[model samples]
Target: MFKAIATAAFASALLLGASTANAMIINGNFEDTATLDPTGLVNGNKLSNLATTGSSWDVFTQINGWTTASGAGIEVQTNRTLRSVDAHSGQHYIELDSHPRPNSNSSMEQEVALDAGKYELSFWFSPRNDDASSNGIEYSISDDLVSGFITGPSVSPLTSVGAWTLVKALFVVETAGNYTLAFAATGKQNTLGGFIDTVNITAVPIPAAGLLLPAGVALLGFASRRRKRA
Candidate 1:
C-alpha cells in the first residue's frame, strides 16, 4: 500500500510538471504579419514620405493579430527605406510612434488565450533616434501594468544605430480566458518612442515537481532493493 501511494503521487507530480511546461502564446516573435498593410493607415491614407520627415498619419486599426487599443494606430516598418537599421529578427518589426504628431500616444495590443497559471513574458524593445527623453512606453498584462521606460539605444537613420534590448515580466492568470498583452506609448509622444520585436510567453517552471522526478525514481529503486532483500 505504501509503495502504491508513493508511485501514484510521483506520477501525478510528473504529469503536472509536463502540463505546465506547455507554451500557450503563439506568434510571440511578431514574425507573422500577413494582415498588416505597410502602405498606410486603416483609412487608406499613406504618410506620403516616411523616409524624409516621418509619417503624419495615425494608424487606428489592427496590424496582424495586434490592435491599436488606445492612442494613435501602430506603424509597421520594414528596412526598405533606410528608416530602420536592423530588425531583432525577420524582415519586419513594429514602430510604436505616432511621429510628426508630438505628444501623441500610440498603443498596440494583442489578446491571447490563456490558462490559469503563472507565466513569464519577454520581448525585445528599442528606442528610435528621434525618440524624446521625456517620452516612453509601458508594458502591461491584462489590466495590470508591468514596466515603463523611455531610454534605450536609438535606431535612427541619422545617427549611429544600436541593438535591441530584451524586456521581461511575470504575471498570473487566475481564470482561463482571453487576456490582453499591451504596450502603450506615454510621455511627450513624437515620431519616435519605442520599437518592439520577438515577443515570447512561457509558463513558469514549477521547481517542486521538477525536482520530484529524480527523487521519485530513486525512491522507487530503493523500494525495489528492500523488496528483494525481504
Candidate 2:
C-alpha cells in the first residue's frame, strides 16, 4: 500500500512539473531597437528607412541579445512605405538577407539558458517580395544540428508579399545549459529572401497519461509481492 501511494505521489509531481514550464527566450518579438542615426544606421548597420542609402547594414551589430552567426548579419526594416510586406507583430521585423546587395547566405543567433526538457520553437516568416522563390531558412538548436527549414513558396506571392506562415520545430535537451539558437538562409540568394518576426520558445508539455505507466508498474509489483507472501 505504501509503495502504491508513493508511486501515485511521484506521478502527480511529474505531471505538475510538466504543466508549469515557461518560455526561455528574450526579445522574441524583435520589436525593441537601439536608437538609429540620421542616416538610419544603428551601430554601423544600416536600418531600412524607405530611403535608398545605396548601402547594406548588418543586423547582428544592432539588435540587443542577438549576434551575427554568419554572413553580414541581417537587416531591420521599419519603413512602412518601402515595405509592401507587413510585420507579424509590432512595428518592425528582421530581414535575413542584408542589404546594399541581397545576400543568399546569412545567419543570426541568440544565447539562452534553459532547463533540460522538450521545447517548441516557433516564428512567423514571409518572403520579402512576390518574386522571392526557392529561398530557405534553417533553424538550429545550440548550433549543433539543423532542426528544420522553411522554404519560400513555390509560387510567388502564395498569399501576399507580407503574408506570414508560422514555422515550428520541437527539440529536446538532456542536460540544462546555455544553448545557441540560430537561423540561417539557404538556397538561391536574392534581395528578397525571408523575414522573421515573433520568435518564441516554450517548454513542451508532458502528457499526464504518461505518468500512469510507472505508477501501474509500481502497483503491480506491490500486489505481486503481497500475493507471494500469502
Candidate 3:
C-alpha cells in the first residue's frame, strides 16, 4: 500500500511538471516602467527612453525583460506618437527599424534555456506605415542570429497599417540549453518597420507525456478509491 501511494504521488508530480505552460518572455507586454526621459518627451514624440545613440528615433538599451541585441538598440513605440494607434495590450510596443535618416535595420534578442521539447512563441505585429517598402520584420528562435534575417516568421513589404496581427511560431528543441529568440527588420532599412507587442513563449506538452496522462489519471482515481476503503 505504501509503495502504491508513493508511485501515484510521483506520477502526479511529473504530470504537473510536464503539462504546465510556462511564460518565458519577461516584460513582454512592454508595460513595465521603462527608463523615462526627464521631460516626458523624445524627438518630438510623447515620452520614452532614448535608444543606444540614435537621435532621430526612439530606441532603448533595455526594457523590463529584454536587452538590445544588435544595431544601436531596441526600438520602442507608444500610442502617443504621431499617426499611431494603441498598443496590443500595454502602453508600449516595438519597432524593428529605427532612425529614419539612413541607418541599417536593427534586431533584439532574448535567450532562454529549456529541456528537449516543443515550444511556442507568439507576439503581436503591426505595420506603422501604408507603404509596402517600409514594413518588414523577421523573427527567429535559434542559437545564432538568422542568416541575414532570412526567415518565414517575418514580414516583408508589409503594407497593412495600424492593424495588429497575432504571430505564433513553434520551436522544436532537440537538446536542453540556451536558445536565442530574436526579431529583426527586413526589406528596406528605412526607419519605418513593424510594431511588435505582447511577446510570449510557452512550452508545449510532450506527446509522450500525453500518452502517460491517462495512466496518471487512472492511478489517481485508484488511489482515491483505496483511501476511501481504508
The C-alpha TM-scores of every prediction are 0.63, 0.67, 0.65
What CA RMSD would candidate 2 show? 16.4
Q: Estimate the overall C-alpha local distance difference test score of candidate 3.
A: 0.56
lDDT of each: 0.54, 0.56, 0.56
Model 2 TM-score?
A: 0.67
Q: How many backbone clashes can be found in candidate 2? A: 4
Instruction: Tell me each candidate's RMSD, in Å, in order.
Output: 16.2, 16.4, 14.8
- Which digits, one per residue and each the tens of the lDDT, describe model 1 over residues 54-90? 5433353665667778766776554442343545666
Instruction: Write the residue-wise lDDT of candidate 2 on 1-230 in tens digits.
Output: 11222334244445535434335776677655544333333345344433234433334444666677776666666434243555567656777766444543678888889787666566777765645454567777864522666655544213235456655555666778998888887756654577777787767566756432221111100110011121
How many pairs in model 3 have backbone atoms within 3 A of each other, for residues 3 or more apart or on separate chains, i.e. clashes? Answer: 1
Give per-candidate clash totals. Answer: 3, 4, 1
Which parts of model 2 have CA positions greater than 4 angstroms off?
Answer: 1-22, 34-60, 79-83, 102-104, 131-134, 143-146, 155-160, 211-230
**How far off is residue 18 in model 3, in Å?**
13
- Higher-ranked by TM-score: 1 or 3: 3
